[model samples]
Structures are given as C-alpha cells and as structure tokens.
Target: MKRTSLIIVSVLVLLSIALTACQPASTKVRVATDATFPPFETVDEATKELTGFDVELMNALAAKAGIEIEWVNIGFDPMLAGLSQCQYDVAIAAITITEDRKKDMLFSEPYINAGQIISVQKSNTEITGPESLAGKKVGAQLGTTGAIEAQKIEGVELKTYDSYDLAFLDLANGQIDAVIADYPTALGFIGQNSEKLTTVGEVFTDESYGIAVCNKNADLLKKINDGLAAIKADGTVQKLEMKWLAGQ
Candidate 1:
C-alpha cells in the first residue's frame, strides 16, 4: 500500500512539471514611461510607485500575453529615443501617435483617442481658443505634440517644460498665458485643482495614444496588439476607462 501511494504521488508531481513546461515561458518586457502625466501614468504620492491608466493597462496586457515587465520611469524625450535605441522594449506613456513617430518606431493599436486642448487660469477671460494663443506665452511639455503645435501658433512664445507639473506651476504663478495639452490629461490635472485652472477651447486636434515599439521588433508588437485586442473584447479596456475617465 505504501509503495503504491509513493508511485501515485510521483506520477502527479511529474505530470505537474510536464504541464508547467508545456506552458509558454514568461517573456520579460521592459517598458519606459514618463510618470508625470496623470491619469495616464504617474508616480503615486504615498507609495512612490508608478500607477495610473497606462501603467495598469500595460500591466494587464503583459499578464495576458505571458510577459513579465520592468517599468522604467524617465523623461519623455529620452523615453522615445531609448525605445528607438533599443534601451527598452516598449514605450507606454500617453505617447501621441503621429506620422513623425511612425517614421522612427511602430505604434501599437491606439489604445485611446484624445485631442489637444487649452488650459488657462480659471479667472482668465482673454483666451477663448487656439487662435487666442497667438501673441501670448504658452506652455507644453517638451517633445510632445502639444509643444510642436504651440510652436506653429503665430507669434506665440512657447515655454517648454520637462514635466507638466512644472508647467502647471508656472501657469499658477502667471508665468505663461496658457497651456496646451491633451484633453483627458488636462482634465485629470485640473480635477482636484479646479479653483486654479480650467480647460478652454474645443479639442484642437485629433490625436491617439499608443504603445511604442521599436520598428524592428515586429514580433513584440504583435504580442501587444493581440493582448490589447483580447482586453478590449473582454471589456477590460472599458472598465479601465470608466475608472480613470469617469467625469472626463
């Protein structure tokens, strides 16, 4: 009886090991982001860990695709450069999908469609739209589509900041006339600071946020896209959107 029990246990253990071996190994994927962008990705004040929509979504996608991830928080400009230079496997900030970026790297299916908007002091009445940005000082994060759009505003003095937190600081201090940023991001930033800031003007341009992969890494891109599709179909994306963008 004891010998039979031992043989049965041994068979079970071997079967467990075989099943585990049959499953795909977890792929370690390194993801880069600028955590200053709230709602999309931010460093939680108390925990000091990256947490937000993009962070959560990236984690979900990685788990679904049997991938382990290392999150790297860095400056927005360098994040893109690093992705292209192969320093990271993915860039998952609220990076806008643009023709210019497509030239350098492949973008995953757009996870969110957002638009550029203007933010101004709550008391300000002078600026009404993008046209009003002309001849005024405006701020945007460096290397963002918003910053690029600001540069084309005739006679506008564009102030570039590494992070939007500093841009909002300058805005509060009346350093810049207004700030141009993504609609959802501006909404998130002003949600708790409504007394100080407000969004103005219609969405200035149609934009989409996507995960950036090295153009050369098609296999990795496919994994991300497949995972994203699964999540979207299973309502994961909708749940996240509702949680993060409820009032916006």
Candidate 2:
C-alpha cells in the first residue's frame, strides 16, 4: 500500500510540472528606433527622454498588445542592422517601406505618409523646383529616401550627410545650395531656423513610413497590423497626424 501511494504521489508531481511547463511565457517586446528625427523620433536635449510621434505610437501599440517594450535608441544605420541581428523585435523609426528594404525585413502597414521636400536658404530664391536645382549642390542625409530622390535628379551635385541636422547645417552655411528631406523633417528644420531657411513650394516624391520587424516574426507582425487597423478605425492615427504633421 505504501509503495502504491509513492507511485501516485510521483505521478501527481510529474503532472504538476508538466502543467507548469505548458503555460505560456510572458511576452516582452523590444523596439529599436533612431531618435534623431524630430516629430517622428527625437531625444530631448535636457531630459534625454525619447519623445515624438513614433515613440508615442509604439507605446500605445504596446499597451494595446499587452506587451512591455524595451526601447532602444541608436543611429539610423545601426537600427536596421540591429533589426537584422534580432537585437530588437521591431523598428519604429520613420523608415520608408521600400522594395529594397522589404528584401530583408518585414514591414507593417505604413503608420504615416511622407513626401520629399526641398529646403533652401531663405536668401536664395532662384532655385524653386527640381529643374532649377540642376548644376546646384544638394545635401541629403545618408541612407534616406531624400538621398535616393536627389540622386535621381540630373545635373544636381548630391552630398550625403550622416544626419539631417548636419545636412541642414551645411545648407545654412551656404556649403550646399539646398537640402532635400522628408516634409515633416524639413518643416521641423525650417521651424528651428526660420530666419535662415525655407521650404520650396513644390514637394517631390511621396512615400509611406512603416515599422520594420524581422521577416520571420509573422505573429508579431500580425499583432502590429491588427493594432494598426484598430488605431486607424478609431481615427487615432489621423488625430496624431493632425497634431504633429498637419499644422506645420
């Protein structure tokens, strides 16, 4: 009888262990972003807090998905590498969903639409459009749609900088005739340097910005897509866009 009791007790212990093992693990998501672009992702100079549309959007998505996010801020170029290395589950930078990028990473539905714009010194009025920019030096941030767009234009001397701020700085110094950048980013730069720079009347190419995730993580991609749909349905995305992008 004692031997029989021992066997039953062992079986109960094994069953309990199996049940515990079968329970799902808590979900923790890590997000990486380039925090240098204002209105999308920028680091507060004083508080060092990452704040902008993308930051807020990611937080909202995490709340809705019932997951905690480990936010990692790094350079733009490194962000893509980190995503490929699986260092983060998603990238919320203002990354354009382009065919080339789609070759390596999965992209969620575009959170925002962006267009290329021209930024010229306030004193210069001769260059008004792409045709006028011929033979003039153009500045753009490296690895950005702006750079790619500028390269497409003939006769313009394309100069790539590490950051938009740097490109804007060169433009301010008269080293570059104009800077090509995303509309929101150009607006932010113009706002800060209203005395020195202004955006051209014409906008160039239009592109959609998306959150990038690992190509293999279909489950997380689905969660993000569902959350994005819900936000759009509730008009949250439009509201945010109006708050951040429309006025300027």
Candidate 3:
C-alpha cells in the first residue's frame, strides 16, 4: 500500500515538471505584414524568399528583443483583423499611424515618416495636384490612408486595388488617371517604370509609419520599442533606410 502511494506521488511530480518544461520560456512574438509592398516587404520573384526593409528590420528587432518571431503574411486588410484576434504580437508593415487605427490597436513610436503622393503616366500632363484631380479617376490600395484621402477629394472617382502593383497597373494601362500612395512606394514604383510614370507636383499629407501591437499586449510593446531604440542607436535603422529608401 505504501509503495502504491509513493508511485502515485512520484508520477504527479513528473507530470508537473513536464508541464512546466513545456511552457514557453519567453513570449512568442508573431508579426503580421503584407508582403506585397516593395522596398518595405516583398517576395523575390526568382528566389521566392521574402526580402525588403520591413523584413530586415523585423528580423533584427526579434534578435535584439531576444524573442522568436513567426511572420504571418496576409493581405493588408486582413492584418488588422488578425491583430484584433490576438494572432500576432506586433505588426510592422509600413502601416501608417492614423487616429482611426489607434482606437483599436496600440501603436509604437514612429519608425518612418512618410508622405502621400500622386503618380501618373509620364505622358499625361493634365493632372498636377490634388485640386487638379477633380473629375479624374484616382487609384489607391484598398484600406490604405491613401485610399481614404483620395475618396475625400470632390469630383474625383476613387478606385481601390488589392495591392500597389495592381493600382500601378491600372494607371499604366490608362484605366486610372493617377495612383495615390506613400512617397517611398511611389518612388520605388516610378523608378521601376520611369518611362511610364511620374510623380505629380509634390507629396500631399505628412504621415508616419509605426509598429503596431495589440492593445492588451503592453509587455510586447515595450520590448518592441526597446528593440527599435537599440537598433536606431546602433545605426541598423539608418543602414536599412539608406540601403532600401535612400538608395532608390
């Protein structure tokens, strides 16, 4: 009878240790991003490997924070939904920090300052600025600040595309008069198609991109902010900016 009691207690202790060992050492940080934005996040055509500024930055930040990162690549619109469901610990997809988004998600310090700009076919000379866009068909990525801004302009018909590439394609095919997007994306797109597209006038709105975390995950936010600061101080941020943004 004593032997049986001793065996049961020993089994219980082993089970407890096993359960404790299975618990994660540190919080697993899942990051969600739309990988279609080039110079920020994109998959290489030939190699099929994800590469760009956001990808590099996130990898570095994970190392700095001593956290393991599982990257979830979904469309831009679904990313917010995933974040809300607690699917990801953070999101860094060149997402603009806007007042509307703040109501649902927590935003980290601004990592990059960006501006909205209009890009048009090089041969089209009529459209020059926001005011000149009246009665024209303007294209922007769906669920983006650029889309919201474009829809606000009177007399301009706003068209939404799932990705910047599709928007640029519409502009290139003369299906849309202009494509409104962040300056970095516009610049990269224009560089790739210099003979086809040109930036009209100047950037319109001043905006900043930030890393997003769920409202309930304050601990994760702190780790990300600390990692960002460390990367900035160590010049990793500058190196990435120069390599991806300035180099273009």
TM-score of each: 0.90, 0.89, 0.90
Write out the backbone clash pairs for model 3.
Answer: none
Tens digits of lDDT, candidate 2, 161-225: 87888889989999999999888888877877889999987777879899899887989998888
Candidate 3 positional error at 241, Å: 0.8
Worst 10 residues of 2 by lDDT: 59-68
Q: Is candidate 1 or 3 superior in lDDT?
A: 1
- List model 3 lDDT by residue over 1-248, tens digit each: 99999999999999999999998797677789998888899988999878899999988987898878888888998898778667777887889999989888999889899999999999999999999999999999988989999988999999998889899988988999999999998888777788899998888999999999998988888988898899999999999999999845
Candidate 1 residue-wise lDDT, 1-248, digit = tens: 99999999999999999999999876898899999988888989899999999999999988888779999999999999988888899999899999989988999999999999999998899999988888899999999988999998898999999998898888888999899998888888888678899988799898999999988899999999999998998999999999998785
Q: What lDDT is reached at residue 186 by model 3? A: 86
How well does model 1 score by local distance difference test?
A: 0.91
Best by lDDT: 1
TM-score of 3: 0.90
Segments in model 1 whose C-alpha atoms lie over 4 Å from true places = 1-24
Ranking by lDDT: 1, 3, 2
Residue 35 shift from truth in candidate 3, angstroms: 0.9
Q: RMSD, model 3, all Cα superposed?
A: 3.3
